[model samples]
Target: VELILIDESLHLQNGIEAILTMVEENPEILDDYHFVENIRQSIIDAVELELNYLKTKFGGTTIFGVSYGELERYMKYIADRRLIELGFNPQFGIDQNPLKFLQKEDVKKLTNFFEVTPTEYTNF
Candidate 1:
């Protein structure tokens, strides 16, 4: 079974939203200017490497890749909304999501917990 992480999946997006909410609530916890950028670059590098390996092993297969900037924009949108919900203003001026194809119905379907089943467990 293949485990896929979709761009608009609530599990992934909500985690990011929570983190940004935390940061906004307690700005002193993260003082580094490059913190978010570093984390974003690391995720981009890791995903690109994994996707490249998959492309090499499974030749002729089309692979869809999301850029670090695109992912950041989506996460920023979620974060901004979350901040507003928490009675705080949005720090990031991202007015739109980069991945516009992920509609509300798609998110609803993707986030349906009953539709997901764990195939295997791996200790992180």
Candidate 2:
């Protein structure tokens, strides 16, 4: 299982779509009408639980975190902590880089200093 948290629901939908593309090509995972609606409801409920817990623990202060990673293991730790804080489980998957499909020099100019290609750099 993987838990993905985003500020906006649409962004979460997009990320889930992209992740499903890499994980067995199951269109069922991306269907909001068929699947996501129910899942989303549960996630929202869980998030509320987490928010209430945080409010009680921190006197209603906003929660924020920063993390960096170059590997799945480390990324998972960061992702897990954040998602668990939101009352969800973490799911592991590669980060998708839409830039890889680009033929333009935009990605090269931006990522020239790094040894890995745009797709590789986007993993983080």
Best by lDDT: 1
Candidate 2 stretches with Cα past 4 Å from truth are: 1-19, 22-24, 28-34, 60-124
How large an RMSD does model 2 have? Answer: 14.2
- The whole-model C-alpha lDDT of candidate 1 against the native structure comes to 0.56
List of clashing residue pairs for candidate 2: 2-90, 2-91, 3-91
RMSD of each: 8.8, 14.2
lDDT of 2 by residue, 1-124 (tens): 0112222333544655564564346655554464644554555465556545554655534333311222223334434444454334554433342223221322233333366564423435
The local distance difference test score of each candidate is 0.56, 0.41
Candidate that scores best on TM-score? 1
Give the lDDT of residue 124 in candidate 1: 21
- TM-score list, all predictions: 0.41, 0.28
